[model samples]
Each structure stands twice: as structure tokens, then as C-alpha cells.
Target: MTDSGLEFDLTRRIGGFILRGRASLPACGIVSVSGSSGAGKTSLLRAIAGLDSGLSGQVRFAGETWHDGTCRMPVHRRRIGIAFQDTRLFPHQSVAGNLAYGAARAPAGTPGPDRAEIIALLDLHPLLKRAVAGLSGGERQRVSLGRALLSRPRLLLLDEPLSAVDTARRNRLLPDLRQLLLDHGIPALHVSHSRAEIAQLADHVLPVRDGQCGACHPLNDWLAAQDASHPFSLLEGHLAGHDTENGLSTVRLGEASLVLPGLGEVPAGASLRLIVRARDVALALDPVPGLSIRNQIPVRIKGIRPQPGTAYCDLDLALDGQVLTARITRAAADSLSLETGQSVIALIKSATLDPAQE
Candidate 1:
């Protein structure tokens, strides 16, 4: 295995089912796994974590092999942080005690967050004194998340840690989870079935099908192939400035600048990744102003995919270097005479951003 990031090429059998997968996780940021139930998602994570001995082949990360036919690293020595759907907290431990248990496992001399930072990032201050047994599902997951981070693991394996939390708390905590991963800068493999979750969090996505790992795609391309409701694209940019009076902020998308509807208090010059839904993007042959859409960038059509069972097509547009998608009716496409290699303007309303996805 090349020693750049996390690599796995393995074969295993469980209950008469054969699983063969090969992938190299990105050196940084979240690389999420999506698959159906009983499709070997958890088994893959378990193999990487050294929790499943039945898996054969190899697992390597950060220039070291954790497993092979002749050599294996103990789970304790792998330096991985794992948070499953199950909280897995100590039955008798207080919230603080459980977190301490994780911090206690930190590898000597490796740099990571101290107790205070973990507590604040996951908003665990209120539950520090509470027993793990008494906390609500969301609260317990927070503790689990904190515990995982405190361990100072070089790799993180997350198995739908948000599945148990209520919808209200899930929405509120999504941003926190994004920030925590972004702040840590370690490579994390998140197992999830929700396309929204994958789009909201993952930089690179790997699709697992019938026990095999498939090619990885950027979030934008993955979502375009999804159903009509999931037409979205993520573009990386930087904050240009803010308009406090009008509640607007300017973001530079490649070569152009967009004045978005209020991104409260975001400082200028900070790198930002913005999410835009394809349905919200309207295409035009020429730049027109004065209506209401705040963003209109010149984009070249790179590719097109007709959305099955619908009258629309998804246009893969390249704006300078970044890519975005536009979902418009086929009739609209025919009327405008759109095709690959054609240049046009992509119009977007700034209000479509849900800050949580940023």
C-alpha cells in the first residue's frame, strides 16, 4: 500500500457472504461510505479498526500497515477514534469520567485537544456531572463524540453517530460536527445512508455496493446523479466582505464575486465552501441584472445528464475552475439550445444557503 493516507484492500466472509473492497481514504477531510443495510459497511470499519479478525488482506494508514497476513497492530495501538451508532459509554461512569477514559488513551507526545476544548466543541459543559445512563440520546452522542476526539486518534471511524438524536437537536448539532471534523484536520471515514449528510459533510465520497468499494466522486457529481430533490453542488470560495446594513456578505467564486444574503459576522479573507442547490440555479445566455438573484457567474457547460423519470436535465457547469450544476426542464434546455461546451450565466439566489452546510 502507498503510504500517503489510509489504504485498504481486503477480502472477508461473513455468513456465506463474500466481501471484497479496495480504497485509499483522502489524506485529510471526511471520506464517507454509503451502502444498503447488510452491505458490509460496519464490517469495513471494524476491519480497519482491527476489531474483526476474519478480514484478510491489508490496512495501512499514515505510512504504516496496521494489518497484513503476517503482521497486525493491536486495536489499542492503532490510534483510531471510533463512535458507532451505539454510544458505547461506560455504564457506571459519569460524563466526565467517560471522557477522561478517552483522553487517557492518547498516544504520548502526539498533539491534540485538551479536556476543555473537547468539552466546548461538543457542548458538553452542561452534562459533565450527569451520569451517562441518565442523559438523553442526543446528550449521550455528544459525550461519545467528545470522548472520540479526546483520544487524539490519527483516524476517525464514525458509524451514523447522529442516528439516535432527535431531529431538532440533529439540525442544531450538524454544524458542530462539521466544525469539529474541520478543526481536527484528521482523516475520518463516516458511514452513512443519508445523501444529505454525505453532501453536507464529505469532501470525497465512496459508494459501497454488494460488498465492494466503488469509485470516489466529489460531492457535486454524486448529488447530480441522485433524485430530483437532491440537486445540489458544493463550491469552495473565500469571504470577500460583508454588508451589515443589508445583511449580505460577498464571496469570491473562482474569478467572480457574489453578494450573498447575510452570512452574519463572517470575517473577510477566510476560505469557505458554499453549497448551492441545482434547482435554485437558473441559466441564461446573457448576464441580466435587477431582478432578485444575487449571483450570476459565467459558466461553461462541461457535461449533461438527463434526470430519469423527469423532464429535466442536469448541466455540469464549470465556472472558472469550480463546478456547479443547473437543473432545468428539458423544454427549457431545448428553448435555450443548451449543449456541452456552450457558455452561459448561472443565476443563484444567495438566500438558498443553510449556514449549517458551510
Candidate 2:
């Protein structure tokens, strides 16, 4: 099968609220649907997968017509894989058995991924023969992912897989899941209410507003919308090396290096994206050493955004081509004589996180 994009112009009414939106997913990247609870994220995903027949509109994927005014493809025939908050694995079955059940559904003689590749991608080798009853929340999610992949689906659907776990566990699991989606190269639509999950995983974002889905936007815009008071920024970097004595991971963003807490044993050259909040960053006109902070990156001011009811404004700073934001008082801005294209150093709190949140 081709690496096909999915598009839909759908409208569905459940109770008094109506869900209406039109959007498209790229041929080979994860698109995240984001909104508050009961805002139609799951409904939209369900409708796209042919599980909700109440929808009326066109559902097209790649070059094939899955649904329209005159035709509706059978849900089973649509070739989609799904993982939800409730993983619903068979308690009586081993993890391998549950995964194999998906493999068994593949049409004979159709060339697709084998179980071994899927197992490796999800890092399920250890849990292969374990009973599903003993799996943790994160482990269950992994099995669910494996089960979905083993089916050799054309498109994968994830509905709040991380939402089921507690904050701490969710933080650890996000990297693993992001790596899996990237490694498999499967086009997926991930549905979640957590901005952190979307920030960590999505290649593009579709924000759900008032039950209506908005057009997709680049990752930067979605991330920058976190909050006016606590503006968010996205940084791309690679693992420089681990400082075992300090128990930190050095992330190199261009020539700048940040010593982030919690040393993950990632490979030296693995690419990593960090979500930095304005509140986590401090500013200075010159470099100061031997402080509590572990990061002191020299950045040039790109622009400023003012927030209502506060003297603090968000500063958009640049390091090489990467962008970051700092929240500081307007008084500080004047005292430091900060301006667009002005050079400054940003002091990032070492504990800043992608759990971003705990």
C-alpha cells in the first residue's frame, strides 16, 4: 500500500453539540488532534476510522474513496489500527498472543511488516511472553501499540495512550512512544488533551476549537500557544553526551549546550526536541558562572510579546536559528536595555521538563 494521506469533511451531532470540521493528515507523519475533554477529539477519530456511521461527508485516503454520499467502506475493510486510553488487551492471553491476534488478521500473501520488526520497534522483546494481566499502564500501552502495528494497518490511530498513566510515568513513556512512531514511519493521527504529548510527538497539529477542528499548522505555532502568561518555545537539539557525575544530559542546540536533569542513556547523536517555557528561562546582558542553574545560552532577542494585566512580557530569543522565549518583567527588559537583535544570555532552569508539567 502507498503512504497515503487521509482527508475528511465531517459533521456529527451527538446530543446538543455538533462536531464539524475538515482536515487532512500527511502521507507519512503524525498529526495530533488537541482540545479539552468532550470536545469531539475522540468522535472525530472514531468517524474517520469508520466506527461512527453518523458522520456525513467524504473520507478519502491516498487515492481511494473510503466514504462519501453514495458509499461507505466497511470498518474492517478500511485497514486501520487503533489504540485508546483503554488498551483492552486480552487478560487471558500473553503479550505475544495478543500481538499475534493482529497478525492473524492480515490477508494471506499480502506483503507487510512481520512480527519481529514490530516487536523490535516497540521494544517488546522482554514482554513478549508475559501475561497481559501483569502489565503496567505504560507497558499496556506498548502492547497496544504492538498489537496495532502487527495488523499491518495503512494508518494508525492513537487516542490518549499516555493519558492513562500518572504524570511521572507519562513523562518517561513519552520519549519511548515518540521514538516508536518515528521508527515505524507510519502515518498516524494521535488524539490527546495534553499539550505536552502533542509537543513531544506531533509533526503537525490540528487544534480543536469549540467542537470544530481548525486547519493544521506548523509545530511552532501550536507550541507557542501554550499560554500568554507562560509562553512556550520549541528547541531542536541532539544528545551531546551524559555527565554521569552530575546526573544530567547535555543537549546541544547549535553551539549552545543545556545540561538538563535526568540522564537518559540515549545514543550520542540521537536528535531530541525540547519544549521550553518562558517562565523557565531567565535573562542577563552578560554571562555569569557558578550559579544554581546549569544552562546559560547566549541568545539574541528576536521580538517581544506583551501580556495583559502584568508587567511581564514574553521575549522571543534566538540562538543560531532555534527560537526560545523568556518571561521577565518589563522593568527588567528596560533595565537590561533588551531589544530586537540585541545579544543576551538565557538562564534555563535545570529541572525544566517535557512532562513539562509535573
Candidate 3:
């Protein structure tokens, strides 16, 4: 019997740089490969995709071996869809032609969106007849992504797939892309440098550092382990109601509620994932009347850690079993006499709350 999911232990040497990666990932959901530049992030993906002949090690997916000591499966035989940052579309092909090429290569009876659905999802209708040479950077990336999805591969590998798209558009597409991957039951290894992208779409994080890829961690666990400088929290809740006059939406998080703006149009009861930066949160001993902050939640101080070099400190606040991180000056924390298990209010500006695609 073979094991399910993806298991890999790959190593490669490029000139003086050596890359080592090992991980056992779930067979579903988006797994993000995150790191800074030249961290061997892409090299790891290439080794798994069978694009690196110099790589040595094993790559097993869903119990099938793609790479091992002597035998090596060809890249095409691996049945994986890949989209790179450079948007490598065929120069001679039109947008439709490029899409058709990917569609033609899809395995028979593969599970995924059909050609028409892909076109619609990427909004490629108008650009279908356009030449690839004329497409903008963002448009090319979209087309490349659409083509990858059209192939209906069992596994997807994306290397900074939306780096060329504007932030607003990328944010809008992330939710739909995440849903699509789920709907099709395609497990993806997504590589990105953006924390926002990983926070919004990744179910798990695979950290690449110093030319090595570490074991996977759940998104929240990974976020909590980071330093206080870029601390953040990911919250999940259902849209409780919308106040049209106030142009705000209330999200129910167990017994607590968070009010946010620009969510009035989101249908009631829709699930939402919110990203709250630690810097954006403030703590108060008592609720202040007529404050500009729209969200004030009752929370308990779970833990506090001081930043060694800075005068600031990090606080772990708990609300109805959910954890929120906050960074405040040591003076303020001392002035209020903050301590573990102490109840306080977490004040968040409505505008500062960024709701990710549900």
C-alpha cells in the first residue's frame, strides 16, 4: 500500500548554492511556500515538478513516485499544472490558442472547470482573439493562470502566479482562485513573497529559508510564530447583518461581533476571513465613549513579550477562544498595568480591518 498526499525529500546544487527541501503535505488545500528572494523557493518547486535533472531525492504524490533513486517520471507524466511568475505563454499563439493548447493536454475525464468556465473565470473573452504579444503584464498572468486551471491536473504548482497583477485585483481573484482549487479538489503548492497573499489563501505554510524548506505549519500557527515586527491575526466569522445607513457589516465570532466597513454588499451569512495587523490594534482598560474606532471587543490578556531592542511589546489577546495579537509601547503596557488573564478592550479602526475573500 502506498501513502497518500505529497512526500518529498529533494536536494540540488546550483554552482555554490545548495538547496534542500523536505515536506509531507496534505492532498488538498493551498499550501504556500514562503520566503525572501534567492531562498530556493522556486528550486524546490522545480525539483518536485521534475524540471531539475540535477536534483537527487524522492518525490511521491498520492502514493505514486515521481522521482526516486534510479527511475524518474517525465514532467508530462506527473500530470501537474504549473504557472510561473514570468507568464510563459507561446509567442506565436493567440490567447484562445494558448488556452486551447492547455485544454488539449488535459487527461481524459479530469475533474476541473471546462474551457468555457475557465474563460469566464479569468475574464478572457475579450482577449481571446488578441495576440499574446499585445497583452499587458497583468493580463498575461491571468491568461497563464487560466490556462493552468484549464489543464485539470491533479496537482498545481504556482510560482508567484499573480505578482504582476495590481493589489486590488489580486485580492479579488485570490478568494475565487482558492474556491476553485477547493471545488475541483486540486491540491496546490503556491509560492509567494506577499504575506497578505499567504494569509488570505494558504491553509498551511511551507517556510523556505537559507536554501532549505522546512516542515509545514498551519497558517495561524505560522503567523503566531513570527516576530512582533510583522505580527497579524486571521479571524473567521459569518456575516451577521449589514447596516446600510452606517455602511457597515457585522460579523459574528461566537459571542463577539466585529463591525467593519465596505462589506454592506456582501450577502448576509457569508463566511469571512479578516486580517488584522498587530500595529492596528490598541488596548484600553475601559471602553471610551464616542471613539472613532468602530470595533471594541472584550478580550483577555493571554501573554505578553517585550521586544528586546525596541521599547514596544507584543500582547496576545484572547476573545471567545480566538487569539489576536497587538503591539504597543512598553510605557503604555506598564501604565495600564497589563497582565495575563486581565480583561481589556481591543480597539480596531473599521477602515484598518482588511477582509479577505471568503
**Most accurate candidate by TM-score:** 2
The order of the candidates by lDDT, greatest first, is 3, 1, 2
| Candidate 2 CA-lDDT value | 0.79
Give each model a TM-score.
0.77, 0.83, 0.80
What does candidate 2's lDDT look like per residue over 252-350, in tens digits? 888888887764655555666777777889998888878887688888899987777888888989886977888998988988888888988899984
lDDT of 3 by residue, 1-358 (tens): 2376999988899999999988899988989998999999998989999998788889999999999998899999998999999989999999999998889889888778888877766778999999999999999999999888888998999999999988766755666677778888999999998876887788999999989888799988886676435777788776789889878888888899988886664457655567777888999999988988878999999999998999999999998878888999999999999999999999975433242322
Model 3 poorest 10 in a row by lDDT: 349-358
Off by over 4 Å in 1: 167-172, 227-232, 237-275, 284-321, 327-345, 349-358
Model 3 C-alpha RMSD vs. true structure (Å) is: 4.4
**Mind sharing the TM-score for model 3?**
0.80
Candidate 2: give its CA RMSD in angstroms.
Answer: 3.6
Writing each residue's lDDT as its tens digit, candidate 1 over 1-358 gives 3576998899988888888889877788888888899888888888889997687999889888899999989998888999988889997999999999999899778787778977875678989999988998878888898889889989889988777776545544555566667786767899987665676577888888888889877666666565546667777777788888888888887778878874554456655567787777999999996777767788899998988898989999998687787889999999999999999999986433342333
Better of 1 and 2 by lDDT: 1
